[model samples]
Target: MNMDLTHVLDVAQLTDVGKKRDHNEDSVASDVSSGLLVLADGMGGYQAGEVASKMAVLTIMAEMKERLAGSSSGKIDVASGMQMESTLLRDAVAKANAGIYHASRTQPQCAGMGTTLVVALFTNDRVLVGHVGDSRMYRLRGDAFCQITLDHSLLQEQIRAGLITPEQARFSNHRNLVTRALGVDSVVELELHEHDVEAGDIYLMCSDGLSDLVEDDDIYLALRTLNANLTFAARHLVEMANDNGGYDNISVILARPRQPYSAGRHWRHRILGWLK
Candidate 1:
């Protein structure tokens, strides 16, 4: 069954060039009806970063929307044993990567362009999240707020290897050095995961600009304090990042599940209405 997320989820997104950057290299796209949201942070020469990011967001959004419209979400992939939604999201990212990489190689001005991506597809009472590079996704449930996606960056690897603590990594000069990114290579792996959705759960997808400058504690406070107003919360987050020096382009997508959404619910509601 196809479910419309317009009423099921409350979503808002915002992007800023920040104080240090003359041009914004970040991009965001969403289809509330389709429950798809994507954010990208690009890196390269001149305006190539902006181009790469826009390409990534557009490609993934278009590809996923078309594929999902023709396919069944519950169908399981024989090779991966994952749901169709998961497979579709992965393939969509791969297609975006290929398109970006080809453009970077064929177009001189776009040479060396690459982008970090984070995407979320909400359906059947769950959210399928996929990402590459250092862009991230965070979830806030109750008083607990945490990062859902791990950054594929040098600092993250250092912290994982015990070479540096989380606190030290925060101050490390290698924070912007991502180990993986789309368009950087011919083939990029998209990390995918599925999470059960709960009412009142808020998910934040953002570029490093916000995460790097805004402390996690501060983010938690902002999100919790303004959970009732996503638009304000989103703008406030961007403002906080800029207030902290805004060293990079900041982008954020805030999504809150207003109610449990299941494909079967549509049919059930129709049947009950007809009987009544």
Candidate 2:
């Protein structure tokens, strides 16, 4: 059975140029009807970063929407054994990477341009998240707040190797150095994972602009205090980043499922209805 999340999910998003940057290079998009949310943080010269980020967000969203129109999210793929929604998101990210990589090679101004991408698709009472680079997704359930996506950055690699403590890595000069990003190469690998969603769970997708400046504890408090109002929670997060010297473009997407979105109808029930 397919579930419609249009009314089940509450979503809010915001982006800012930030205190230091002359122009914003981050892009964000959300479709409540499709239960899709995407965020990209661009890195490049002049307006090239902005172009790359916008291209990624638009391309991914368009690809997913077109494919989803004809298929059920709960269907399983024979080859990968993953659900249709997960495969769709993976393919969409690949398409977006190809488009951006092609443009970077063909356009002189866009040379060396790339963007970090994070996307979430909510279906069957679960969220399938795909990401590249340092852009991230976080989840807040009950009193626990934790990061959902692991960054593809130098700092993260160091932490994994035990070269630096997570606390020390936070103060490292190489925090902005991402080891992997879309458009930087001909092919980019997207890390995808699935998480169960519960009612009252708040998911945050944001650029490093917010994560780099605000501490995790502060973010948790803000979300816990303002979960009732997602709009205010999103705004407060961006404001906190700016207050801490927003050195980069800031973007955020906050989504909450107000109630359980169980997949409609069991197989036996459907069979009975057909007989009736």
Give all candidates' CA lDDT scores. Answer: 0.93, 0.91
Residue pairs that clash (backbone atoms under 3 angstroms), model 1:
none
- In the order shown, the candidates' Cα RMSDs to the true structure are 0.9, 2.5
TM-score of 2: 0.95
User: Candidate 1 — number of clashing residue pairs?
Assistant: 0
The clash count for each model shown is: 0, 0
lDDT of 2 by residue, 1-276 (tens): 245578789999999999999999999999888888999999898899999999999999999888888887689999999998888888888898999999999999999899999999888778989999999999999999999999999999999999999999889999999999999988899999999999899999999999999999999999999999999999999999999998988999999998777565334555899999
Q: Model 2, 42: alpha-carbon shift in Å?
A: 0.8
Which numbered prediction scores highest in lDDT against the true structure? 1
Stretches of model 1 off by over 4 angstroms after superposition: none
Which 10 residues in a row give candidate 1 its minimum summed lDDT? Answer: 1-10
Q: TM-scores, in order shown? A: 0.98, 0.95
Give candidate 2 regions above 4 Å deviation.
Answer: 265-276
The Cα error of candidate 2 at residue 251, in Å, is 0.7
